[model samples]
Target: MDMSWPHQSQPLPRRRALAAATGLAAGILLPTRTSRAAASGPTQASALNAAASYANPVIWQDFADIDVIRVGTTYYASASTMHYSPGAPVLRSYDLVNWEIAGHSVPVLDFGAKYDLNGARGYVRGIWASSLAYRPSNRTFYWLGQIDFARTYVYTATAVEGPWNRLTTISTPYYDAGLLVDSDDTLYVAYGNTTISVAQLSPDGRSQVRTQQVFTAPPSVGTLEGSRFYKINGQYYIFLTRPANGQYILKSSGGPFGPYTMRQVLLDLRGPIPGGGVPHQGGLVQTPSGAWYYMAFVDAYPGGRMPVLAPVSWSPDGWPVVQLVNGTWGSSYPSPAVPVPPRPVTPMTGVDTFDGTTLKPRWEWNHNPDNTKWSVGNGLTLRTATVTNDLYWARDTLTHRVQGPTSTATVQLDHSAMRDGDRAGLALLRDSSAWIGLERDGGVTRVVMVDGLTMDGNWNTTGTGTEVASAPVSGGRVWLRATADIRPGAARPGTFSYSTDGTTFTRLGPVFSMGNDWRFFMGYRFALFNHATQALGGAVRITRFELSVP
Candidate 1:
């Protein structure tokens, strides 16, 4: 595919005929009313309100490749964090419908200097398909992930919110592997892409003892990977994701290494919801009351693969049934049968004062950050680095997932420390991305907007961005904002705006198209980036960032 940003001959129509065709006016394409929710604090609602009932996308944000485990009444979830620092983000929940970030497995994925963004890059290739498990023997939690070009690593911690320790590295590939500790205290791993395999691990969980091919899917199955192993009521089960189909299960009455029978557990291909694609790849958990539920994800674009919760049960013949109402996935389901604690409603997006001693759990870096170049005190200070125009390769680009349906983010940037050839702004980042920011050239600074695409077929390399608009700025500080309207039936591209007084705002540039590239395997993220094109002393200080959603 052509990676360069496609140039448009004319600005986007102020009120496109397409909007009228869709029965939506151009004026309603973006948020017209200011959000009443507090911009500086978390939103408040009865915690039991959401817990009393919940939706399919239990977690509305991007928490993909999820593997969840239940210990007692508490549930813990782990997800893939490719190329993002603090890889293998762990989340905790009581009802499985609500979740909050607990901590991370690796503080930074520094397997090689490339992860640190020194010379090489790790885009689309850091940690993939991690398996999280709780070992009853030692009362320790384990996280395992496969790193491309590197081997698989096993991380261990006594608590889910952890000071995790890198226990060991296994030489075996184990692509999208899952771990299981049997009642006999023996450990086994299940993994494969086309042909599935099982292996016995040493008693200490450091090395493989033996291996064998257990099962293989037919060629008709498309894109089958991400195996999750489980042993329920004396039967061994393996759940594999077939994008062409839904989630399929392999069951064996005998043992881990099995003569297993294959059956489709979640084949409601009618789409994730009423008019969506099939939900794929996640783990299953049982509540304390012995109720089973499956947690999976749908390939939702511009917001990434979002998690969905579904009720489940076993058939008399020992097959797993992924429950669907009537003939489609329901938008809302009865909440999980767990204690619904009276806690503050967890906001998917929020404001960051940058006054805390540590970065918020919601914040993540594009790649492993260079700690020496950034600091957080009165605000976030990002010292510019000599990186190319490819924002994907730029260091210290702090980011969070863009909220779905509709959402808006605004940041106040102090560019007084910025030098010539420095660009500091807010961006919507994916394999394809666009930004609205301040660009300093020599002694003159300009408010600029640019958009670019990263060619996935060509090893995911980004081309120089195409400038859409620019205007000179006289001040050292400015506020930049982006409004994303990703609601179903709404336009895919979002609008960019700028403000000098922090109240009134003016729109800029054409509506930039949001990318749905599958290669990046993620949704667009709202990012804060500051990089230098010439020399390195440019710095940008962000005093405040506020995110609100409707």
Candidate 2:
């Protein structure tokens, strides 16, 4: 039986007494049932196990470079955009478990002239990693990040989700700007590369007024950056992770523009640099309850780097240290006091039988989509309007955002007639640089692969298998499925299978593996595309898209 509850998905109304009563009833009710069940044996948390796991990413998906901050009663978390369009969409939570989109600070990014960020797949056109800082002196929330040619810039507002102020360009070559506001309300920023520098921001919080000064970095720490400053125990502390190593902590008597001294290597990866691996950037924050915590990005598998959080302790000498036992962070921690239910590990569920009234949030646009290419009313139909290779349909093709590996997506395609140059296919596209698609040529369908901006022949050079067959679409209803089984340190493998009806499927035998984590920055995306060709028959229709993971 398919469980489709549209009413259950809507947000509840706000009422003080009613909410209080509901909370009290929920607190008394659920645990009682769970306790009774526990007496039998260890029981399932809820009916929606996949949703619970997806909700708590630490328990399921691989989350990376997490920057989190508490604003008012809400906690907002944002991660590094591996390279998709609208940059990184910030996820918001009241406690940390139940999360929602908190609105993007960098909504409209101008990469430069000519190359609009609209799906131009190259180096860094969209938002990269960003730092979220709350400045009370001006009552402003600041988002600092790096875009393609624009370099490092800061967008400030009084709200977390904002009609943000214009970009405050910091002319420095620093990549990631870690923002901090001291006890005296002095604003400061830190960046790492060949040199680590700390500078004081002007009172308006728009520009840096003080001279940039060098901060303490161990002679052994090579090109370490992503530095952040926090005051603890009457001493200002600098917490930074070596991009090529583990994390380090330093202390200074002065403020951000400080004569700081290196304290200790809080956490260290085994072996030397360059060839030897180290965990990437991380974020550190103190909870309201006075517990010190550290959250860092870890690449557990070669191509599967995500975020993990660990607790930190202060040594007798006032140096901070990360606790690790057999060489891994603790697996579980208590959720915040606010009762956010654990989410299912799998998010996109059920058959998205596209009767076409609403478009799912799981579907994403390439860079920024043009509103004209798609319409939803009956079955969701994508109209091929633009022909220019430089147009919006080409630039902002429909794609899926990267969640994690071990997931599957199935979409129903209807392509009876297609133009000669115009092609429609189910594509697993990382960017224009790397993509693999199942395309139909004449009466035959072939699986093709592209690596770093260049498309190979019918087969992949890196051992990806291939298959050719007669075009499967005879009457209408054609189902294509893509499954990704990604292991972190190794190559992520994906397969494309097809079926005439929705039931049984035949393996097309096209296998492709994206490189391991830390080697390149990219996101996994699934898109149904129809490119314009001179041939008159190049148009396709999508009835529905269903995605699930086992």
Give all candidates' CA lDDT scores.
0.76, 0.52
Over 4 Å off in model 1, which ranges?
A: 1-51, 272-275, 460-462, 488-490
TM-score of 2: 0.73
lDDT, candidate 1, at 324: 65
Best by TM-score: 1
293-377: candidate 2 lDDT, tens digit per residue: 4666655432234555444555666665654433544333333333223331123345665564645544545555445666666
Q: Which stretches of model 2 miss by more than 4 angstroms?
A: 1-63, 97-101, 113-121, 124-126, 136-140, 148-150, 157-167, 266-280, 300-304, 333-394, 414-420, 431-470, 489-491, 533-543
RMSD to the hidden true structure, all candidates = 11.2, 10.0
